[model samples]
Target: MADGAPAAAATDETALRRDLAAAYRLIALEGMDDGIYTHISARLPEGPDGQKRFLLNPFGLRFDEVTASSLVTVDESGAVIDDPHGAGVNAAGFTIHSAVHMARHDAACVLHTHTVAGVAVSSVEEGLLPLNQWSAQFHGQLAYHDYEGIALDLGERERLIADLGAKNVMILRNHGMLTCGRSVAEAVKLTLNLERSCQAQIGALGMGLTPRPLSDEIAAHTAAQYQKGYDRIEVDGRPDPEWAALLRRLETAAPGYDA
Candidate 1:
């Protein structure tokens, strides 16, 4: 058994790599990825030195092709501490993720996307509407921030954090949508729900018929339920078993994510 320890460690590393790779593939399959623009990041486990860092996708890689090994570890300053691919990290990616992570400790995993429906809804003056169950889930939980060009300015972090406030989901007005969660699974799920809501809303609007809006009471109730689901673990610091299962599923589907 002693001789097998190294092999076991290697196996564990491979599993993590495959799981992360699968996440990227799943994101692409859901149509939430926008070329090479969006990013998803998770904080690394505490290191030997008791330092906490994060893992992010390389700057130019497509979401579908991102693997766990391809993820670059960076400090709070956005400086890459470990990157095997040698692909320089994007400054804007660092600006956005760093600000949110620093300001909100609850946000262990951050997912940002620029889908067609998401960008379209962001451009609308009314913002997200409580037209159905999906939108209703975000009734009182969504925040909006005005656009200020590409997110390359570190100075914008203050305003971004200010607008985000305590909300988990944010619409970057005229830009895109962002979701943060206590873990990568929750963040990914939030983004998926947000995208689905936007797609459904846009489809409803294009029909040219007056869409029915949910009653305030119903909407509030639905939003409460959704919050409860996220809060069940986020606030309690408990690991989500469902998220672990998801990683395993991804491993089966795309075996190189963590590589």
Candidate 2:
């Protein structure tokens, strides 16, 4: 967070910071951002003392303005440590992210967005219809959590976790979308696909015509394919080509996240 501040597992934390910052910028660049409202967060590897923590964008900074060094480290209790920016964090961000980070240890990064289409889909009773390939990937993997208001209550974390059980993505009813991943790249990719799928659904529904949804069997098969990995061109286990391309896009569009 600050110069000379001690970082737990510096190498791993540094990499996560860059990746998380890049996700924030990409979201903003793609017009998926909601001012400084939504948050993208990453879980930090354990330190020597085995303290559980995660990185979240400091409150008040727009996603496009986020840099690797500007991210804040939040402990398991949602308190910011090594507060370099001293910006604290949005209460809703802490509540939502803390819920997932605590309940889902496997989620290395979590992305939340309030895009118009996303909110529209969330408000729908059907919730993220599996009408397209982009949406099919989450056919049965998407969860739904009823909005209990502004998410300021820490007590709501339990209900949130219960609603999101064993799912990688969720639609907060009357709110927006949330996605978590084993990596930042995965999280961003899922969010991108989710947003596209939402937009497509909205467009289809706006036509006042009955839309043909993907068959349940097809949706299941597509979700399986995604689980097997798609567009993954890995060489010696380095960054996947899809992720590399995304980073390059960020570099050209909104650089300086690695700072």
Candidate 3:
């Protein structure tokens, strides 16, 4: 039984690594990455003592360079658990990701990005405007955190969680955007949607025309309509049809992530 438990854990972690690696490649493919700045993290199985650990990219690797075996494991104290040869996880990046992982147990995957559109929208006073279906999906689910320079201090984690509250998406004021989910595919989906929302908002507002925004009631309805159906839907390697199709696309477009 003990041996079987270890083997099963290994198998589960292998699947997670593959999914996370694939997410990195997909993000890079979509031009959502910011060199090596932003981060995507996955919470690992807890220890008997309930110690938390996470899998994060090595500090210097570009998103496209990430592979399943190249990820590094780290604990809350910024200690690297595995891969002594790793470039080490980014200390500043850990501050943002650890805050979400520790507070929101349901957020198994946390994705952060510093895309131009995301940052542009974050800088605006209105936040994400529900201008379209993609934008409406985040209507009430989006939160905001006033930027506080670089996220190098562990002390900031408290305010980060407080700002995020129960929402799965956030705009780091003057910074970038964040999205979290119970599965890697779910997180990827949220990131893609949120990024699209920001892009649309910027593109629309960039034009001088005063576009009509959705009514609050309608936006709320659409938010639920768009995302609530897929809540934690992926299981046992069977993602929803959308995520399954994405993985298939990766097989052809970005093949080496699973390696």
Candidate 4:
């Protein structure tokens, strides 16, 4: 039983590491990454004491280079737990992810990005407008936080958490975007949809005509339908069909992420 316990722990850790690494690779494939700067973090399954530990990418590695073994483990304070390579955690990652994981117990994974489309939408005075189906999915659920410089200051953590509130997705004003979910699949899916919404709004604005906004009542109804049916099959924190297909895509493009 003692020997089996160690094996079980290793299996759980490997599964989470692979899921997180796959997220990074898929983000890179979708051109949503900001070189080696952006981060995706996952909280470890709780132990007997119930203290949480998180997994973060090594500071210097590109998203394509991330693998199950290359990930570094850290505590709630962002201190490396058993990092053999001496790779340090990113300050921005620590500040943003740590703040959310501490505040929102439901968030098991947090993804942050700075893509051209995302930042372009974020810079606009009117934030994300409901110009299409993708935009309507967010509707009233998306939060917004004003960029407070580089996010290195400890003081910004509280403000960021307050701005995020109970929403799963947020647009960092003049910065970029962020999303959290009960699983990596959920977080990645939200990021993909948010990015598409931002891209569509940009294209609509390019037409030089004032884009029509959806009525609040209509938007609310659409969001409710999506939450009830479109997001069905959220069993075990993993959505079927889409998430299964995404993992297959990752296998073909970046097969060694779990290695």
Clashes of each: 9, 0, 0, 0
Which scores better on lDDT, 2 or 4?
Answer: 4
Tens-digit lDDT string for candidate 1 (156-234): 9999999999999999999999988876667777888899899999999999999999999999999999888777877
Give residue 153's error in model 3 in angstroms.
2.2
Could you tell me every candidate's TM-score relative to the true structure? 0.86, 0.92, 0.94, 0.92
lDDT of 3 by residue, 1-259 (tens): 5759988888999999999999999999999999887889998898667888888898899999999999998897657888633698777777889889989999999999999999999898888888998998988888999988998877788998999999999999999999998889899999999898888888888899999899999999998877657753643444489888998998999888888
Candidate 4 per-residue lDDT over residues 1-259, each given as its tens digit: 5769978998888888988998999999999998877899999976557867899999988898888888888888888876744678675667889999999988989999999999999998899988888999899989999988988888999999999999999999999999998788889988999999999999999999987989998888877876765356554333468878999998899899888
What TM-score does model 3 achieve against the real structure?
Answer: 0.94
lDDT of 2 by residue, 145-254 (tens): 99899888888889989999989899999999999888888889899999999999999889999999999999999998987773342213445778889999888888
Q: How close is candidate 2 to the true structure, as a TM-score?
A: 0.92
Whole-model lDDT values for every prediction: 0.81, 0.86, 0.88, 0.87
For model 3, what is the alpha-carbon lDDT of residue 188? 96
Ranking by lDDT: 3, 4, 2, 1
The weakest ten consecutive residues by lDDT in model 2 span: 230-239
How are the candidates ranked when ordered by TM-score, highest leading? 3, 4, 2, 1
Which 10-residue window of candidate 4 scores lowest in summed lDDT? 230-239
